[model samples]
Target chain A: MKKISKASLSKSFWRWWYGNLTCFTHEHMQTFGYMWSMLPIIQELYPTKEEQAEKLRTYYPFFNTEPQIGCIVVGITAGLEEARANGAEGIDDEMINGIRAGLMGPLAGIGDSLIVGTYIPVLLGIALGLSEGGSVLGPIFYIIVWNITSIWFQKFIYDKGYELGGNAVEMIVGEQAMAFRESIIVLGRIIVGAMAGSWVSINTSVILTYGLDPETGDKIPVFLQEKLDGAFPGVLTMVFVLLCWWLMSKKKVSPVKVMLLMVILAFVGVLIGFFDPGLSY
Target chain B: MSISWLQAGLLGFMSVLAASTPAALGTTVGNYTLNRPLVASLFVGLILGDVPGAITIAIPMQIIYIALVTPGGTVAADLRAVSYIGIPLAYVTCVSQGLDLAGAEAQGIAGALGALVGTVGTVMFYGTAMMNLFWQHYGWARLDKGDFNVLTKVEVFLPIVTHIVISFIPVTILVYYGAGAVENFKSALPMEAWYMKALFTLGSLLPAVGIAILLKSVINKTTDLIYFVGGFALAKSLGLSLLAATAIGGMFAFVNFQIAMASYKGASSGADDEEDI
Candidate 1:
C-alpha cells in the first residue's frame, strides 16, 4: 500500500458510504457482544450515500467520525474484510482499535440501556418477585430481548453498514434524524422528570410537634409536612431523591453502587421495621 | 453442570458479553463490540422453548435503538452487562414466569448488578485486550505496523484466541447458573419468601431512581423537566399504559429534536453572518 500522507488523509471518509452496518453488528452482536451499543449509530446510520456523507462532514471539523466508536468498528471491520477478500494482507490492531473508538459509543447506548436499563430490570424483577427467581419468563424475556436485538441488528446493520455509512453525512440534517433526535430528547426529559417525581413522592410522613388542636389532642409536624406539601408531599420519595442527589453530587458514588446500596438498605429496612408498609418508610 | 435450559441460555449470553472484549480482538478486530440484551433473551427462549418473547423484546429494542451510540474509547451503551444481566431478566419475567419486565421487582437488583458488571468488566477487558494487542503488535512479536505484511500474521492472530476465551467463559457460566439459582431459591423459601417478594417488589421502584440517575447528565435543564414531566404526568394521572407512555415520550422527544435542530441551525446561521462580517 502506498504511504498516504496524514495531510492528504481526508477528515471526511466519503468512501464509507457503500459500507454495511450489519458487518459491524454481525461481529459485534453475534460474536463478541461487549462495550458498544447501537445508540450511537442506530439513527445515525441511514439508508443512503448522501446521508452517510452528510454525517461525516458534520463531524469532520471536530475529527469526530460519524458512526462514533461502534460504527467506527463497522468501518475497520469492512476494511479488514476488504483486505482479506483481496488476499493482499490481513488487518492490524491499531486500525481495529480505531474502529473500537468509533463504535463503542453507538454500541454503549444500546448496551447500557438494554442490558442495564431494560434487561437487568426484567431479570431482577423476576428475581425480586420469586424467591430465587420469579417464573421461567423472567430469564426468558431478558434472554430473548437481548439475543434477538443483538443478532438481528448485527445482521441487519452489517449488510448495510458501509452502504449506509459511506455518505449519509452528505445528506445533511434530514427529516428522520431530526424527528428521531427530537423525540429522544423530549422522551428523555419526561422520563427523567417523572422518575425524579417518583423519587420525590414515595414516603412522606412528618412527626408532629407543637402545632395542633389542643382539644383534639392531636399534634402535627405541620411545619415539615407543610414544607414537603409544597413539593411532592412524600417524605420517603423526597429522601430517596435527596439521597440520590447527595450520593451523585456530594459523595460522588457511581449510580450502580448507589443502586446496590439501596437494595441493601431496603433489605435491612425490611427486617428492621423501617420499611413498614403502613407508614411508608 | 447439567444446567437447566433457561439457565444455560442466560449463561450463554453472559458468557458472550463477558468474552466479547477478548474475543473481539481476534474476531471483530478489537472493536470490543457488544449489544447482548437480545442475545440473552433469545438464548433463554431457546432454552425454555419460546422464541416469540425474544422477538417481542428485541423488536421494540431495535426501534428505540435510535438512542444508542459508542463514541471513541467511551462506552455508548455498555452491552456487556445488558446481555449478561438483561436477557436473563427477560427470560425470567417473560418466559418461565409471567411477570412483565417493565415493572418487575427482581429486575432492580439484577438490572443494576448486570449493568455494573458489564461496565466494570469492559474496563478490565479493554485494558487486558489492549495490552495484549500492544505486545503482539510490538515487542518480541516483531509485528509490522506497516499493514498487510508477513511477520505481522503470527503477532496478529495469537492475542485473539486468548481474548475470546477469556471473555466468553465466566459470563456464560454466571448467566447459566444465575437464572436457575433464582428458580431453585423460590422453591426453598418459607413464608418469609413473601417478604423477599416484597423486597423484590421494592426493586421495581429502583428503576425509576435509575432512570433519574441515567437522565441526570442527559437532562440538565428546566425545559427538559417540562418535557419529561408532561409525558410522565400524562401516563401517571391518566393511568396510561407503558406503551402509551412510550408513545407520548416519543412525541415529546420529537418536539425536543425540533428545538435542538433549530438551535443548531441558528448556530450555523450565526457562523454565516460572521463570515459575511
Candidate 2:
C-alpha cells in the first residue's frame, strides 16, 4: 500500500493556499497553480521524475473559481491522486477531471455569494462602525479576525475534503447546505440594506421658496430636503440606490457607466440647484 | 500632506502585494485583507504621518466599495488602487484645499478620487494578468519536456517581475507626483467653482453604485428587495446602528433556517414512507 505522508499533504496544502492565484491568467486561470500544488502529491506517490511529471500533467486543464472555498476541490484531487497510486479501481484521469470540473462551478457560486458577498460585508460593516472616528481599532479588528477565521475555515474544509474524498461534494451542495446558504443570503441582504442606510447619504439642495422676514429683511428658504425627509427619511438616497440597481441589473449597464452617468447627473443636478455639497474653504 | 518618495515607494510595494487577480502575498493576506480600503487606511495613515486623517478619508471610499465581489475574476473597481492611490490623493487634496477630513466635502472628494483611481486600477489589473501569460507559457513549455521544477519559478518568482513593471513603478510615480499636482489644482480651482461643486456632488452620489453592485449579487429575485428595504427602514427610520440591524437580521435568518430545514425533513420523510409502502 502506497500511503501519502502527512508532510506531503501539508506541503500540498500550503502550495495551493499561497500560489493558487499568484500566476493567474485569463487563458490558463488557475491551471499553473493547480499543477504547482499537485507536484508535491505526485512526487510523493511516484518516485521517478518521468512518472511524477506524467501524474502532475493531470491538472493541466484550465481551472478557476472562488479560490478560498475552492480549496476543497484541491483536497479532493489530492485524495483521488493518492487512491490512483494505490491501484484503486475506477480511479483514473477522467474520473479525477470529472470531479474537478463538476465542483468548480457550484463552489464558485457558493464562495462568491457566501464568503465574499455575505461574510466579508458583515465583518466590514462592524469594522466601519468601529472606525467611526478614524480609530485604528476598526482595521486592526478586521485584520486579526478576518485572517484567523478565513485561514481556519479554509484549512477545515481542506481537511474535510481530504478525509471524505468524493463524498465532500454532498456536504456543500446537499439540500441542507442549500438551506443554510439561503438563510445566510437573507442575512446578507438585510445587512447590505443597513449598510446603505448608515453609510450612503444623498440629500437634495433644492429650495422650494424663500420667505421674507418683515423686520429683519432676511430670506428664510424652505428646503426640499426637509420636506422629503418629513415624508420618508432618506427617500432620495433609496431612490438613487434603486435607480443604479435597475440600470445595472435590469438594463444591463456596467458599473463604470453607471458611475459616469452619476457624474453627469451630478453636473446636471448642480446646475439646476438640485444637489450641492455646500463647500467653502 | 505631500507624500515623500519613501512613503510612495512603500505604498508601491504594498500595491504589488495587494493587486487583485494575482497578488504576490496571495489572495487572503494580500487582496482580501490589505487591499480593503478600511485596512489600507491604517497603513496609509502610518506612511502619511496621519492615522486619523487617512481613516477619515477612507470611510467613504470603503463604503463605495463595501462588497467588491470580483465574480469570475472580473473586477468593477480594483481596491489596491482605491486604497493606495486614491486615499493618498484624496488626503492631499483635502489638506491642500483646507477641507475638514471628516466633513461631507472631504468624503465626497475622497469617493470621487477613489472611483477614478479604481477605474484606472482595472487596467493595471488586466495588465498584470496579461503579463503573467509570458511566465505561464514558459512553464507550460518546460512541463512539456517534463521539467517539473520550473513550476515554482513560474508560479512565484516570475510574477514578481510582472508586479514590478505593472504595479510597483506606476503606483510609486503616480502617488509621488500626484501630491504636487493636487496642490496646484487646489489653488487653480477654488472650492466654489462649478466643476469643484460637481466633483463633490458626484462623490456624494457614487456610493449608491457600490451598494447597487452589492445588491445585484444578493437579490436573485425581486422578493429579496423586502429584506433589503426592511434593513434600510430599520436603520433609516429607527436610527439603528449596523450591529443593531445585524442582530435583527440574524433573528430572521434563524427563523428562515428552521423553516427550511423543517420543510426539507418533512419532504424527505414523506418520500421514505412511500418507499416503505
Candidate 3:
C-alpha cells in the first residue's frame, strides 16, 4: 500500500471514505454526514485526529446541517484537555461521532421544551401588548427572547455536557434540567390556573343591576359583586382543568380529537363573538 | 446523460415528499424523514428563493409539534403544516412558484393545499413503498445478496416526486376555486344585534384550555405546585408581570433541580452498594 501523506491522506480520506457516501439512508445524510465531516476539517488544523474524534463522538445526534450549528466543538475542547494531560496520542473520527450521537437527543428534548415550548409562548403573549396599537414589538420580542435563550442554552449545555462527559447527564439532570422543569411546571400550572380563573370570572357574572334609586338617582349598594364572588370565583377554569384531566387522563381522550373539536369550536366562536378577549357578543 | 439543474432540483424535492410521510416511519421504503418541517422548509427554500421564509414557518410548525406525542399507534399534531403553511407561504413569497405568480392568491392557496396533500401523500407513498420489503426479499432470493441501496433510491425518489406532484394539484384547484368561498366568508355580515359582549366573554376561555394542555407536563411534584401558587399569588398581590413570575419560577426550578439530583444520586448509589454487598 502506498504511504499516505498527511495532506493527501486527508483529501483522499474525505473523498474516498466520506464522499457523503451515506452508509445510512441518504435522507439522514445531513445529520450524520455533518458530524463525521468535521473530522477532516479539525484534523487538518491539528494532527490529533483520534483525539478530536473522541471528543466529538458524544454529540452526534445534534448533527443537523441546515443552518449548520452544533457539533463536537465543545467535546474537542474536552479532548484537547485530555491530550494535554497525557502528552497524548490523537483521537479518531468514530469516537467523535459517538459522543455527538449520545448527547444530542436528550439535549434537544430539554431545549425544545424549555425555549420553544414554554418560554416562547409566555414571552410572545406578553409582548402582544395590552392595547390595539399594533405594536411591531410582539414578533420582535419573541424573536429576541427566543434567540437569546436558545443560544445561551445550546452553548452552555454543549460545554457542560463535554466538560463533564463522564457525568454530564448527572450534572445536567441535577443542576439544570431538574431546575428547568421545576420552574417550568410550577409557572405553567399557575398560568394555566389563572387563565382558567380569568375565563370563568370574565364569563359568568350575574348582573344585579337595579334602576337608579328613584329619588336621588344614586345607585344603592347591593351585594351583587359579593354574591358573584361567593357563588363562583373560578368556575370555568375549574371546568377547563377537569375537562383536560378527564380527556387526557381519566377518559384518556386522544389529542387529535381534542384538537379537531377545538378547531371547530374556535371557528364557530369566532363567528359568534365568543372568543374576543375584551368584549363579547 | 448528466441531469440538468432543474431536473435534479425537481427530483430532489419529489424525493422529499415520498420520504416525509408518517407511514414512511414504519416502512423500509424511504429515508426522507429529517424531522419533517425543517427538511421541507429547506427543500422549498432551495427550490425557490427564500430560506428565511421556510425557517420562519418551521418555528410554529415545531411548536405545534410539541403537542404531538404519538404513543402506541396514534397520530398527534398534523405534520401537514409544512404544506399548509410552507407551500402557500413559499408560493406567496415565490419559492419558485413563479415570479409571474407573484402575490397570486392562487399560489398561496395552492401551497396550503400542497402542504395538506403532501402530508397525506407522504403516508400513501410510504405505505406503498413498504412493498420494498418483498422486493428486497426477492432480490435476495435471486442473488443470495441484496442491496439496502434500493430503499435509499426509492426513498429519494418518493418525497421529491411527491412534493412536486402534490404541489401542482393544490395550486391548480385553488386557482380554479378562486377566492370565492373565502370572499363570501369575509363579506358575510355578523349578527350585530345580539348580546355580543356575552359571546365575546365566553370566547376568552379558549386560550385557558390550550394553556391547560400545555401545562400538563410542567407540574411533577407538590413542591413545584406550591411554587406555582406562590408565583401566581405574588402576581396578584404585588402586581408582578407574568413574565417576571415565570422568571422567578425558573429560579425555583434551579434550586429544585439541585435538590432532586442529589437525592436521586444518593438513592441510586445506595442501591448499587446494596447490590454489591
Worst 10 residues of 1 chain A by lDDT: A30-39
Tell me the spans in candidate 3 whose CA falls farther than 4 Å from its real position.
Answer: A1-109, A130-132, A159-167, A174-188, A191-234, A260-281, B1-178, B186-206, B221-240, B247-277
Candidate 2 versus truth, CA RMSD in Å, comes to 2.7
State TM-scores per candidate.
0.50, 0.95, 0.49
The models' CA-based lDDT, in order, is 0.40, 0.88, 0.39
Query: At residue B181, what lDDT does model 2 achieve?
Result: 90
Worst 10 residues of 2 chain A by lDDT: A163-172
Q: How many Å off is the CA of A36 in candidate 2?
A: 1.1
Please rank every candidate by DockQ, starting with the best: 2, 1, 3
lDDT per residue as tens, model 1, A1-281: 32222221111121122111111221122111211121123113333545433332222111223232233345334433334323444334444444444455445553443333433333333322221222345344444454455445444444444443333222213444444544554565555444444322343223445677779878745645456555633434535644664576456676556656766776666665444333110
Instruction: List DockQ, one per candidate, in order.
Output: 0.17, 0.65, 0.13
- lDDT score for candidate 3 against the true structure: 0.39
> What's the TM-score of chain B for every model shown?
0.53, 0.93, 0.43
When 1 and 2 are scored with lDDT, the better candidate is: 2
Candidate 3 lDDT at A217 equals 96
What interface RMSD does each of the candidate structures achieve?
A: 9.7, 2.4, 10.1
